[model samples]
Target chain A: MTAENQSFQPKLSDSPLVVGNHRLSSRLIVGTGRYDTMEQMRASLEQSGSDCVTVAVRRERLYDRNGQNILDFIDLDRYTLLPNTAGCYNAKDAIRAAKLGREILRTLGNPGADWVKLEVLGDSRTLLPDPTETVVACEELVAEGFGVLCYTSDCPVTAQRLKAVGAASVMPAGSPIGSGQGLLNPNNLRIILEYLKEDDPEYPVIVDAGVGTASDVSAAFELGADGVLLNTAIAHARDPIRMSRAMQYAAMAGRDAFLAGRIPRRLYGAASSPSEGVISSRPYGTLGKGDQGNSQSGEG
Target chain B: MVEITVNGQAVNLPRPMTLEEVLKRVDVPPNYLAVEVNAEVIPREEHSSHSIGNGDELEVVTLVGGG
Candidate 1:
């Protein structure tokens, strides 16, 4: 739908999404990767209206002539920079990455620099998280005073373990990383949500990774997800800028729909119009003279 | 000469130097870089005192695009 024709204003919950004591109004988090240029990344981020963006810690471009850095393009004042350990494969490496991110943030004087998006992949093929290593890293990072956002599979047990280990937010992947499969096992996600909410109703459960399009994001929010972290869905879209806007609106729509309860389904079709209106002149069981005697007659 | 790896690239320095001096030699802005010596993070406050020796492995990381 065109922007001019769209009139639905989502009635989002007044309650803010809280993660590690930081309250956020926007539920959609975008990433800075996979875009063709930094300009596209910036535009998409602006269009998405995301309050948070993830960045990886890599080697500095010490010898580049252009002297352009990703940080230079991003507005630190507008977005909360969530540094991630995307390349790290083990707990030790992930911990070091997190520490390095904190150091960089400390130098920049960002208040939320201590927060890290901890991801430790098990292998290179699937790019799935290693649950054992993830738990170990979460414990250490929490002890080191870092607000850890743990990424894991859509397993309720693993999510509970991460939360128990002091992860500020439990991010369960909808599917494999960068696969764009989009909520492959929604029933498992539902169970995770139910289990977490049973323990604490306000616990933040963000669906991270494997969101292909706007509908995937909306579905996650409809499943009672607190937030969504996506990169390829917007960055790799045919038109990243437009896709970003679509994702933003979809997130709002999904959250509002979840809040507004839906109706139950039945075997028989139910009429929405008033049944008391009597437009026919014939009696309940009596047929008019013009009507055929057969029940299959075409008379109304 | 002291040989060390910086971001997985081997580099030879004339002599042992502090992390701060190494950063200046490499032309990296200290405020935007995080230094890790031998896989351990060296806080900004310790850059002046932290020394790089022979065969030391240093990883200087800056923020980059990621999901």
Candidate 2:
């Protein structure tokens, strides 16, 4: 039953996700933040099954000789480092952060030297992106030849606008950053996937934030998202390494399920067993009866 | 001597020196760092020769954890 069936290889069904000038074997992108220690961050990232890791550009802790950098714990040869413009609220400052990130990566000779996770926040409280500033930053980055992965709210029009403005990847948030809400608006995300991947199906549409658990990651992929980028979902977990493993499996299963295609949703239950070969009448006739026909089966 | 701001802290350099000299004097990690002076990025190659100036605001940045 096994020898002759070995003609099919599992690799046949595998497809890599393509971002700006990069091809990734993993659909999940995890961040190197919020872990209590560098070892935990490293372990979580190792379990996350991601080929790319995001880092923020911040002031080099001056005068503290004992300060440790995320770079010391990360392996550039194994993972591509994606630097982000996290704390910037304006296009000008975001642009500055992006440049600083690029310079740092470039100096380190990491492959992510040419790209950025562009985030231009609006209100400090909500941390929602200002669409206007984001657009401006996207154009400027594109002009400067950086592969811009733009993050914005789950607005279909904004997603489309980011794509039109030359964002390498249009990452729409499932909810507010660090909210841990799992896909608050799936319909909006569906519209975004449709709008962004209409003609260019290979265009990467990553669900960027508000992933609470492994199910959230899978839900995003099942919604036909190309990838999911998360941080606090793992970092805030009770056991980050285990959660990271769960997330990895969820990503694979969800993508496979999406590719397998789900059956249509129906209002009524459809019996898996054929009614033609029924051995006996329904025992709980009252269940389907009162709910549908209310017929009494005397043979019960 | 010239006064320059590095990472928002005012520092009085004993003498005007190249960017690398200032980085060495401050004892910051030379790897994975980017220097921005007056909002303009200074490439790595120029750091070894670029001279520090009076009242120049510098921002030295590196990669940290975030998403």
Candidate 3:
């Protein structure tokens, strides 16, 4: 069904996105990690037109020699920093990191941050999201008044659980993190989108990782994903700014296509047969039952 | 001889050595991150065959897993 069939057509960013009551202008989120250089990172961020960027908090006390906070590189005024528990492998660690982030924000004169990038990895090889731990953490975080942006498996069940637990948005992987695999499971992604639409039509469903190029982002948008969260694709690209712009256009195109409604696919050929006007009557090929069909055995 | 640090280890380099020569003296895994000379970050393409003189404090910030 097209969006026209629905009772309401919400704007892409109309999902009541007030993280910690801070209103965001854009639904697009970008990760501020993995760029080849700071210049490229900044350029990519500017190109993506994202209002929020994800940063990971490390337990170590290491500092760059310049005494500048690594995160300070990004202009905080322009972007809302969403500290992610990227290193956490389970619910407990991720939850603890989120709490620590809130505590750190308090000391920074910043209030408790309600927005968190909840990442609970199942395996490092594929960097797939652990549905079980993710749900556990999301439930806990949602109860704590935190708006969770859960990085989950591209599974309908996981998406349903996140939505049921009041996740601000569900972020399913396009493939694996940093794999540059690019939508390895489009079927599962479409399934998740359908599930979200049926379950909690109001909440936004975003494709988080495994996007290798602009087309990948477009593909996600085409599948009705509200937005996308990507890092490695642009960071590792030969031209980060170009890649970032490409991704931006791709997202727009995908969203536009989804809104416009894609055309249906057909199994049998349509009425326009290329050979309909041509005549060919010179074929003498046959195959026996014992043969492996070296020749056509069907009626013309 | 002037002391230069490579990945936290102090070593002696001649009065003048190109950045490239110093890299050969030290073992660093090529994976991610841009090279830095003193406080200035340098691109990877310039890393090979560049020269660094003695008494030059080079700080190479390698990018690792974050976010």
- Choose the strongest candidate by lDDT: 2
- Evaluated at residue A254, the lDDT of candidate 2 is 90
Give the alpha carbon lDDT tens digit for every residue of A176-265 in model 3. 888888898889988888878785565578789888898998888888787788888988898889988888788777777877898578
True contacts kept of 3: 0.18
Rank the candidate models, highest TM-score first: 2, 1, 3
Candidate 1 Cα errors over 4 Å, as ranges: A1-13, A60-67, A278-300
TM-score of chain A of each: 0.87, 0.90, 0.78
Could you tell me which 10 consecutive residues in candidate 1 chain A have the lowest summed lDDT? Answer: A291-300
Candidate 1 lDDT, A22-120, residue by residue in tens: 777799988898888888999999999788899888874643345667888888888888899998899999999999998998998876697999999
What TM-scores do the predictions have? 0.89, 0.92, 0.66
lDDT of 3 at A103: 43
Sum up the clashes in candidate 2.
1
Error of 1 at A170 (Å): 0.8
Alpha-carbon runs more than 4 Å astray in model 3: A1-23, A65-67, A107-112, A266-300, B1-65
